[model samples]
Target: MQALLALSRAIDRLNTFVGKYSIWLIFAATFISAANAVVRKVFDTSSNGFLEVQWYLFAWSFLIAAGYTLLNREHVRIDVLNSHLPKKVQIWIEILGVILFLTPVCVLIIWLCIPIVAERYATGEMSPNPGGLIRWPVWVALPAGFALLLLQGWSELIKCVAFLKGLGPDPTVKADAKSAEEELVEALRQHQAAAGKAP
Candidate 1:
C-alpha cells in the first residue's frame, strides 16, 4: 500500500511537471499564428507550414495536459446527485469510474493511436497541403497523451483506495484550495460589491 501510494505520488508529480510546461505550447502557438498573419499581411506571402505548425502545437498542448487536468480535478462533472451522496459512497463511485471507464477508454485510444503514429512516421507522411508540416508529430500526441491520462487514472485509483482504507486523506477534496471557477466567482462578487458601494 505504501509502495502504491509512492507510485501514485510520482505519477502526480510527473503530470504536474508536464502540465506546467505544456502551457507554454499554447503561447508558442499563439505567437506563431500572430507572426504568420503579420508576415502574410506585410509581405503578401505565407507558408502553410506556419499555419499547420500552430495546430500541431495546440493539439500537443491539449492532449498532453489531460493527465494534469485530471490531477487538478479540473474536468467537468455533473455532480447534482453526487454531491448529496455519502463521502465513502462518492469515493467508491470514483473508484469504479476510474477502473471501469477511464482506464479502458484511455487504453483503447492509446492502443488505436500507436500503430497509426508508427505508420505515419515510417512512411514520412507529409501533409497534403504544399509547404505543410509532417503528420506524425501531431499523430504522436494522441497515444502519448492518452498514456499519460492512463497513468493518472491509476494514480487516482490508488488515492481513492488509500482513502477508503483510512491510510490517507480524502481523495476528493481539492486540498483546501479554491478551484479556478470558485476564485473567479469570488472576484466577480467583490467587484460587484465595490461597484454597489461606489454609488
Candidate 2:
C-alpha cells in the first residue's frame, strides 16, 4: 500500500509539473495571435503558419492541463445527488468512476491515437494550407494528454482505495484553497479598496 501510495504521489507530481508549465503555452498562443492580427492589419500580410501555431499552442495547453485539472478537483461533476450521499458512498462512486469509465476511455484513446501520430510523423504530414505547420506535433498531443490523464486516473484510484482502508485522507474532499474565480474576485475587491484609500 505504501508503494502504491508513493506511485500515486509521483503521478500527482508529474501532472502538477506539466500543468504548471502548460500555462506558458497559453501566453505564447495569445501573443502570437495578437501579433498575427497586428501584422495582418498593419502590414497587409499574414501567414497560415502563425495562425496554425496559435492553434497548436492552444491545443497543447488545453490537452496537457486536463490531468492537472482533475488533480485539483476542478473537473465538472453533477453532484446534486451524490452530494447528499455518505462519504463512503461518495468515495466508492469515485473509485468506480475512475476504474470503470476514466481508465478505459483514456486507454482506448491513447491506443487509437498512437498509430495516427506515428503515421503523421513518418509521412512528414503537413497542413494543406500554404505555409502551415507539420501535422504530427499537434497529433502527438492526443496520446500524450490521454496518457497523462490515465496516470492521474490511476493515482486517483489509489487514493480512493487508501481512503477506503483508512490509511489516508478522503480523496473526495476538495482542498481548502480558493478557486481561480474566487481569487480573482477577492483581488478585484482589494484593488478597489486600495484605490478608494489612495484617493
Question: What TM-score fits each model?
Answer: 0.90, 0.89
lDDT of 1 by residue, 81-181 (tens): 99999999999999999999999999899889889999999999999998988899999999999999999989999999999999998888876588899
lDDT of 2 at 181: 100
Query: Model 2 over residues 107-196: C-alpha lDDT tens digits?
Result: 999999999999999999999999999999999889999899999999999999999999999887677677789999999999999999
* Candidate 1 local Cα displacement, residue 153, angstroms: 0.7
